[model samples]
Target chain A: MNDTRQFHLLAGLATGRDARSDDAIYQSLWEAIVEHRLSPGARLPEDALAGAFGVSRTMIRRVLQRLALEQLVTLRTHRGAQITSPTPSEARDVFRARRLLEGALLTEVVGNIKPADLQALAQIADQEHHASREQAIRLSARFHTRLMAMAGNASLSEALSQLISRTSLIIAVYGRGQAGCPCEHHTLIKLLETHDLAALQKWMHEHLTGIEASLDFTASGDALPDFEHLFGHHREQNAS
Target chain B: MNDTRQFHLLAGLATGRDARSDDAIYQSLWEAIVEHRLSPGARLPEDALAGAFGVSRTMIRRVLQRLALEQLVTLRTHRGAQITSPTPSEARDVFRARRLLEGALLTEVVGNIKPADLQALAQIADQEHHASREQAIRLSARFHTRLMAMAGNASLSEALSQLISRTSLIIAVYGRGQAGCPCEHHTLIKLLETHDLAALQKWMHEHLTGIEASLDFTASGDALPDFEHLFGHHREQNAS
Candidate 1:
């Protein structure tokens, strides 16, 4: 909720890791964002993050740049970085993409799902039942990403992973006390075990559809641009 | 091709542009790479590129970092950056991803096809006919990306754009005297005019299949990674 609490969550994700590499920092920050510990529009000060992670500002800058590219973070010229708040249109785009991509990918997953794969997925679903709210949401994303990876297309998997991460941001912004997946992931796991292609695809479709339907798009207006912060440096240079 | 020739093509792309900003430099280098003017595994030295583009090496590094994120360029720790050479398996993955994503997206294009959209697509296809080989390949990628944009999903459009760019890399790697899309984009344009969803989907599937078929996957082995180049910095540190 606050920066200190958010950094604590990141520390938990980074526990037992002494030397925080780029990936470790990125993963910790990403988890905190997707888990809603770091709410949308929360500023990510370079010094704060660098101090929290015991890394240099250069390392934090690299991680921030990567996250900015993935759209989970927004970096302005002079305004610094913040967790991205997905617009209503971007939310719709993410859901539509998930349905079209995840639904189609389920067929490949159904065709080639091994028993071990099913077990691994079920384990994640089971873990979600006891996870904290943040952990549950992250696990939900992990479930979908892991399931889709069965289709074995690295490009789709990678792209969907980004969408999945953004879906967390969307849920944080528009969700009215609703979970990202709740119990639906377990049911989808069951459908995978059944191996009915039609059933699996149908469930995947309705599952994504149901999640999209639950979001309250009208609740949030687009964040007004900070024109002062945007042009303050230009004004200073001109005055000088 | 030589670095001089590659930089010349980049210069042409950057023509009439004095301020070679990051996007300008990125666009020029991206065009060169996708157009096959910059071959797979071509080294992109920072000093040479900075001199050619008249930008700081820092700016060039940022652009290269972006391309590296998109998988168009590979940046090693000590080896600097080079154009990505997608492997046989990676090529197959790209084709499969295209068939699934593009085939699904065409249905949306058919559902929302407009006369003007079709005309615009036709214009790109028309230009492809008269363009040189490199220009034609870039135009063909543009046509597919443009058509998919009509589906009205920014997430899918952005994801597909990355895949389309990588497809250019794939084609450069394994193409055996073949064009990226040749003349099939025109047929796709015609189908969009007709608004036949089923036909459009089928045509897309076969069109992608044909492109994948034309690639000579068996002809090239994965580039034996330069191990000495990979670990050269570590060895130098130890010796020091």
Candidate 2:
């Protein structure tokens, strides 16, 4: 897909704007990376990204630096920037961290969950059921992030969301077919509706463990993805 | 105090270096803020900091940006950067986050605690006991951060560490006299030695809650600190 069309789809933009906010730019790139449209180990050339986003290279660099801080992107001394390829060990650490965090966060979720939160989660689950693989993966991250946000702890929710994003990088590296449990989210929503913290925690632990288990760590890494193919269309559009 | 002297003491440097790595610069400034050497609401002027660190404004700006990402510093449009003066609500959110994270993380710490880990913690507690109040506060943060790192989850450790640093900022704004529980680290170390996970988690929760309770959120905001006094010494030295 062309850059504008892809951004429109990924960012869910109704109409094109001349210049995007830093957050809008970050969100677009973040969603693209997490949804696996931008593969792990893909080079994010600043010039091409600037061209695509119709912004300065400096703006692109700022977004990349923020992503690097979240561990979704790797910035090297001279090598510039690339999507982080989470090592098998790093992948396991991410899952273990999630199990501990998301599992513990259930107490707060149970304490604070309301009908509206349940409805919100159920809606995400429903969307996940019908999305394409990429969209489903993105929706699944949204599901967990949204569920955890109901806990009313912004710090925990923010940290967990970063982990959720990194999970996409893990899936990019080692996923065989599924990046997230598309069907299982509905089950989670059902469990949440019950307000059984133990059951919810148990289910979350098993669910994350299952997703981790399903990954093929034996899967090899990606070769550098084609940035030109990804953003060349935008560069052309910008030039025109 | 002079910036060089402050850096020397805060970073514990034995010798002066011609240049500091970004991490080194970040570490020095981070320690200063968390120790309350750099008060909340203190302006971190780029030119002054660049001179103090003997680096380019660009390098100083990068360090400031990193600090901003961690929420220990706030960067504003046209206003430049300053130490973050967290609102009372933000302070409470930070404590709540720590209670959830550190308390939950104790399970992993208990599972992973070895004699060396305990020894390392005890050493920090020992230092805290002998250190000045500022040093003690910094050591206390080190104590908790080091303790959490034993959980063996880098992501959680990193996330919790940021919260711990922000806790310092919270103390800066709302703290009455104590920044951290200077005397409690030894107690926590003793609890760790007992290997009682539940008790350890309980102590951690109470410990963080107590610190939060001690803060006087009614405290007035800081006046814009005298940057000329804080960094001007280094400017003169640089010119010489």
Candidate 3:
């Protein structure tokens, strides 16, 4: 398989920087990778990425660096960059860390969640319920962020956000890529509504464990989960 | 006060790039600020810094970017960079975050501590006992990393490290520069030594609160807390 082919074909015909922000490029790339439109081991060559995103190499580098910082990409010296293929051990570590943090995060999130925040959360669930599967997935991921923001600890939220990106990469590389399923959001949301802090915390832990269990890290193979369906189908609109 | 003079005067006669690395430069600069030789609001012009550190403008920018990332420096668009003067609210936010993470971190650390790790903690305390106050301060700060490293969560440790650096900058700006008193380290080490998880956790909370209470955030004006005595007499070796 051509390592760069998936990213190259997905690049589309973006031309010029006037309209595309690094953030837009970053989000599109982020969506593409998580959704599996851009598969694991896909090359992120600067020139190709620059042309693909309608930005300069410097701009592309900025995006790549951010991805690299989060371990979504491995920027090699002369080898350019590729989506991270986490080893089985690394896959386990990422999930372990996630469970530790999110489990701890929920105690405070539940204790501190106000009625207005609960209503906003119900609104998120409504949006997820009404939206397409892909949008549901995106909303589900955003649900966690909303919870974190409400938790009111910038440090924990920031840490978990980075871990979530890494978890997406892990799912891309190791887990089945059905990462955004809306299974646990409502359970926690309902728990929060009733002010059941203990169960909310317990539910949060199980939710993360469930996510980890979905990854087939026990079996050894570099299989590509289908991209278009895993994350969402927003790329056609997002690909500049 | 010449804005650049503090850093400029502290910039030693570094000859060329071959003589120094960015890490070395960063450590020197870190020690200088934490030790109070380079006061808050000190200007860090690229050329002067480049000349002083004997590195490329790119190298200097890399170092500055790191310090900026750690919230020790503020990189304005065209105004260049200055050591950050964190507002009182930012100061409080940092401590609040620190208290949450550290308290959470202690439970895991105590559960995971190995005999060798305990010995290493003792050794760190011993070094602090014998070293100069500045070195003791540095060691005390490092003791936290060692504890977190043993906790074995890279995500949590990484988050706390960034918070610690920001906390140091907060202390530099709002608290006395004497931020590294060896107050909490040995006590926590003792608690960990005895495997007292509950006390360890409680101590970590009070430890952080005690540190926060030590800062004088409500007082007005940006007076340079006389750098030498506040931190230590370590600058002659570190000023460059």
Candidate 4:
């Protein structure tokens, strides 16, 4: 499989434009974990990743540490890091937190959005509408994040960004849908343009509810991969 | 000055309710910076801090790195670390961020608070009213943080907590008031208890406005102590 091509595909979706190596790597790894390409309990060895990316261990370590801090990767005592694989309860908690934070942010923005801000959002929605399935999915996710950024709260924006990233990861792992439907975005933009606060709030609440309802949380029962072999190169481990 | 006693005094105000070496070191240095005990542009040497804390240099380094990440302390390229005196633009951004994020969170909590939650909030408000001036200020801060917590958004709560802490630090340096009164808390709690969403939002907006109004940003032209020397003992640098 062409990992790099797959990464580019995901990265293009995330940014609505071509992304650099660091962002591509980060987004690719993030999506892989969320989509179960890198399943929970799978190891991520720095040296192996460095070799794969043709980058320094230092760069890979920085990205890994960032993920670890987000609680998407668990850094064990001496065992190295693995995908978080949030428990059912943690997954529920994540959504609950999102509902409170993002929902409130959306409501506030609905009341205060400027025409210029709406224009920017419309541009993103238009881009999503025309993108490929994966690109569309990525843009759909970024839409809400971009809205948070526009709200002008760095702290809130940072937290929401993390949550949104994690949510994408969760959807990648468990989502079962056509990735590129811009229907929700269309509705949201219309509400914003009209300055209908009540309608906007209702639409946002339903949108999140729809997203949450779409997850397939039933255990897939897929066989777990070998951690050492998956993380360390198969040939390298055998040669050693 | 009894450093340990001073440590205890500040530690009592921090969330832990117990003063460990690291917490003591963090609180003391944080206060020193916020209180202008350690002025901006002063250097902090590890060896000096180690001697002052009666701990190893490793401990000092860890604390310094954490503060650097929070942007409370600046780790210069070759010049070493010092308290971060935020630029005027940065300071304005912080307040702007706070108003948008906290204002939204408060509005949501007010609209959605339950009777049980109101009771808990009342208890905290009562405690704030009866506590010491310093304790009251801390408790009042906690009351807002607790509201975020009850809203059940971990991400929002964490972000707001960090912002509140940084704001408190900023206020310590630039605010005219030496102590925070309980009047605001009382008013906020009353609004929450009444379950009047419109009134609650108004109260929160005004409360934050009042806080921003109290800041004295003009330079006092007071000669401040060296930041490095406040945490660093003169003997240790000479010994080294």
On lDDT, the candidate that comes out on top is 1
Error of 4 at A33 (Å): 5.2
Better of 2 and 4 by DockQ: 2
DockQ of 4: 0.22
Per-residue lDDT of A142 in model 1:
92
> Per-residue lDDT of B1-240 in model 4, one digit per residue for the tens?
323433333334445533246657787776655444555555677766665566676667667866775667788666778766665445555676667667667655765778787787778888877877555655666777787776565656666776766666566566775566577777777777777877766777777777777877674312354456466777687889
Higher-DockQ candidate among 1 and 3? 1
Is model 3 an incorrect, acceptable, medium or high docking prediction?
Answer: acceptable
TM-score of the second chain of model 3 compared to its true counterpart = 0.80
Which is the winner by TM-score between candidate 1 and candidate 3? 1
Candidate 1: clashing pairs of residues: none
Each prediction's total of clashing residue pairs, residues at least 3 apart in sequence or on different chains, is: 0, 0, 2, 1
lDDT of 1 at A197: 91
Instruction: Summarize candidate 1's per-residue lDDT along A115-213 as a digit string, tens digits.
Output: 888899999999999999889999999998999899988989999999999999999988989676757888887777788899888888888888888
Candidate 4 regions with alpha-carbon error over 4 angstroms: A1-40, A50-62, A103-123, A126-135, A177-180, A217-240, B1-71, B74-81, B86-139, B183-203, B217-240
Which tens-of-lDDT digit does each residue in B95-211 have in candidate 3? 777777777777778779798998988899888878886566567677777888887777667777877766766766666656465656777777887888888878878877878
Higher-scoring candidate on TM-score, 2 or 4: 2
Q: Predictions ranked by TM-score, top down? A: 1, 2, 3, 4
**How do the residues A112-167 of candidate 2 rate in per-residue lDDT, one tens digit apiece?**
97899889888988998888888888998999999989888787888999999999
TM-score of chain A of each: 0.88, 0.86, 0.78, 0.74
lDDT of 3 at A166: 70
Q: Which 10-residue window in model 4 chain B sums to the lowest lDDT? A: B1-10
Q: State which candidate has the highest TM-score.
A: 1
The runs of at least 3 residues in candidate 2 whose Cα sits more than 4 Å from the true structure, single-residue gaps closed, are A1-19, A221-240, B1-15, B220-240
